[model samples]
Target chain A: MKNAKPSSRRNFLLTAGLGTAGVAAAVATATRGEKPRAAMPGATEGSGYRLSEHVQKYYKTTKV
Target chain B: MARMKFICDAERCIECNGCVTACKSEHEVPWGVNRRRLVTVNDGVPGERSISVSCMHCSDAPCMAVCPVDCFYKTDEGIVLHDKDLCIGCGYCFYACPFGAPQFPQAGAFGLRGKMDKCTYCSGGPEENHSAEEFRKYGRNRLAEGKLPACAEMCSTKALLAGDAEVITKIYKTRVVTRGKGEEIWGWSMAYGGSDKLSDLPGGKA
Candidate 1:
């Protein structure tokens, strides 16, 4: 067998492809089981009282 | 940090009672208690109008003023919530309310009046948020879930708008400006009277 390395173009493409897959996998793991982000600012789940995400949704619907 | 409020556009309401259903389902409210209701003016007439009615959560709530046991309290967001544990079921709040928001469920077979219940603006009562007892006593803590009141959200026609007073007022104003008419918000004058001095009217109070 030839003792030669792969072409630089192939090596760069392989590295880029692996790097993107690794980043996407990390993101998916980090976000797993976490609650969705609130649509409105300053709204937190399990609160006494705060402006809520539903307000944002309502605003969208009421757009005139 | 915004003061919560509800504004129902009478012109858009179809009297479908979807809001009532949503409220009931969300809270699993017991029988004979309605936290929200519909009121139609000039029913069966050409100029008929339907408006969803509930606790307006007034800035200076009359219910708070009249509660004998002092169970009523106002949140930072201006929501008027009462403690069922402390409520005496005297019905004074019910009588004092302009919209008749307070409701007393029949507790016993003889129709005994139970503790008062009303709209919490979907913020729930003083109980722990998202707890089973809280859900049982009040309704779903939609506010805690970063959601608005079910009745307003479920309104198919977007008639009922609930959120920060400024935001909803802006939405309503845009609709009014676009329509070029119906500038008179249905319950705004009654629930929250304007700054028009009585002396300025045709009849002089001064």
Candidate 2:
């Protein structure tokens, strides 16, 4: 009976280790290099505002 | 090893909004969201000048550091980017950014902030290049085409420049030294309060 108990405990530990590995593998597959979804599509595009030639010259001078 | 940067000439701005239009047309940017805008400090005055403002994409990006989910990242070229999927819409980046670069859309009726949005410097997001998924989430993938940003390309006066830091700085420096008086404006010291020499500015030293 003592020997039987040890075998059962060893089986349980092996199962737990495999379960942990399986969960980790599944998570890795799910999240491997997945791109995040955008909250607002095209939200960062420029609004249609133009700078005049004179203003352009000023921008050129001030750039770092 | 050098990161890219932007230097706007507040004095040269004409408020014509060419860069804004170019950006909109190139990316088909949706209404109510401005990737670039004109900010006039002194309106209706003799000294009034329109300054174009957008993501400054700082070196020590506060958005990247503050993100709880490690969503924000930087490109090899120094362009700051973030993963929209990982973002929790916490609004920490918006508060941390000095240039007010981060933006969020209202998702919940209670005005809860959604995922953050900001300029990508035309590089697109963390998806496969030019994929439909990338387009749906981020926008156009102009960097894949080996072209400069549309806003800079479409600048009627060539006011907005987007390129390698060294190249752009050389162009600006040539113009400044030639103009002499504009040197104060060309380097960051005069623009953002540093030294008069370009090498004196942070990241300005070679």
Candidate 3:
């Protein structure tokens, strides 16, 4: 009812760490048949872009 | 030159999952690849409401920014798309997306994550329109056909509206003013955070 109490920061950190490990495992499995590249971090920015008005409106509505 | 959007009116959503079915059927999205879903708050109570969610296709898309391989790109209509060829299955997009929009199929041996998949807003992918390759990679190109998204079209309660922002906002405004119960839900801060003056909140800038 209250949206699971907004998970604790510790829980979030644990989950993030576990998730990263899981993704790394998945990536390892994926590249088993192919050559593996060194892992890299995500990009910090993208080409300057914005959502259309239609997409913007989704977040504009009031919560029920 | 306006960007398209999808607005879900939580008060009106019935959680029939019609939108989910429509998306899966329209895209043949395969098992475990949920392009859309219903998130309900206050379940089984008077104030219980379900909101359909997918990729908001954010303006400063975290997925695009977080992709290690620069696989994502934006369409002229402001739809977010990605190239399967460039994807490394690292799952950074999944981690970065606020809406949990991106999904991956476990293909190859050892449960490897396959190409990232999500709602294309019915505009399809980077390939040429209506080609088999495009269909295989990105599903259908319904936008080029001048049709609305399958999810919105199939929404039994008309709760999910997808189209040009101006058009959908006008429709929502009319509904709100006519129904007279939407002022509190008119902006993101209030609906999601229970605060109308969201810009004043920590880490927020309206």
Candidate 4:
């Protein structure tokens, strides 16, 4: 009975290890195929601040 | 970090329509669909002024807000883009745009509306950058190529400036100060006069 428990535990560990390897391979393949966004010249040269509503309000104030 | 922007000095614009032509030619924009154009306030008048108009890429874009399909997305550079594949040709964006930037091309035997088209700030759409799919739907992705919008770069008078906002604003401010800003704008009154008093305009605590 003790030997049976040990074998089942080993089997569980083996299944878990294989499942993890399969997930890692899938992630690597997906990442390789996906094209990530590249930085633009403007973004590289200057502060790439998001143009939010507060900025628009500030721009309205500066309109001469 | 360049905050991409475009500013056209009315005093320098001669109504040449050069900017319009540049944008059209660069993108191969279809017939009857203009992504950029010159708006002259008082043509023929001595002190008349003109400004090139297009999508300003507003911080709070109404088109983005109103798109029922939720196709619009803003890039890190503040360029507004949309996925043509997701667009349903419902024309909600056309009505929502304050600049009249959204355009529709007539299609099919029934004359149905094609997908929505707009300036894109020359940054193209959500498609892979500079891909044929992007070009066929949204025209060129010049910004990704490290180039300014064709309209501003090709302006003959140097009136239309496009770059990081701070740089262009500085250039515009210097010109205005050095040249002695004019006291009277010929068509400003005609084009923008509704009421002199604030109370006359439609305003109340809804």
TM-score of each model, paired residue for residue: 0.74, 0.67, 0.68, 0.66
The model with the greatest DockQ is: 1
TM-score of chain B of 4: 0.83
Best by TM-score, which number? Answer: 1
CAPRI band for model 4: incorrect
> Candidate order by DockQ, highest to lowest?
1, 4, 2, 3
Q: How accurate is candidate 4 locally (lDDT)?
A: 0.71
The docking quality of candidate 4, as DockQ, is: 0.04
TM-score of chain A of 3: 0.41
- Poorly placed runs, candidate 2 (over 4 Å): A1-64, B184-206
- Reference contacts preserved by each model: 0.52, 0.00, 0.00, 0.06
> DockQ of each model against the real complex?
0.21, 0.02, 0.01, 0.04
Model 1 docking tier (incorrect/acceptable/medium/high): incorrect
Q: Give a tens-digit lDDT track for model 3, residues B1-206.
A: 75677889887899999999999987788898998999999999998989999998777899999898999998777788899888888889999998999999876677589888999887778776655666777887666544567898778678998876655665665565456555346564433333554344343334
lDDT of 1 by residue, B126-204 (tens): 8877666677788778888788899998999999998888678767766664675554546644543442233432332
Candidate 1 vs 4: which has more lDDT: 1
For model 4, the chain A TM-score is 0.54
Q: Write the per-residue lDDT of candidate 4 for residues B70-130, one digit (tens) a residue.
A: 9999877777888989999888888888888888876556647888888888777877775
Better of 1 and 3 by lDDT: 1
Candidate 3 residue spans exceeding 4 A from truth: A1-64, B107-111, B184-206
True contacts kept of 1: 0.52
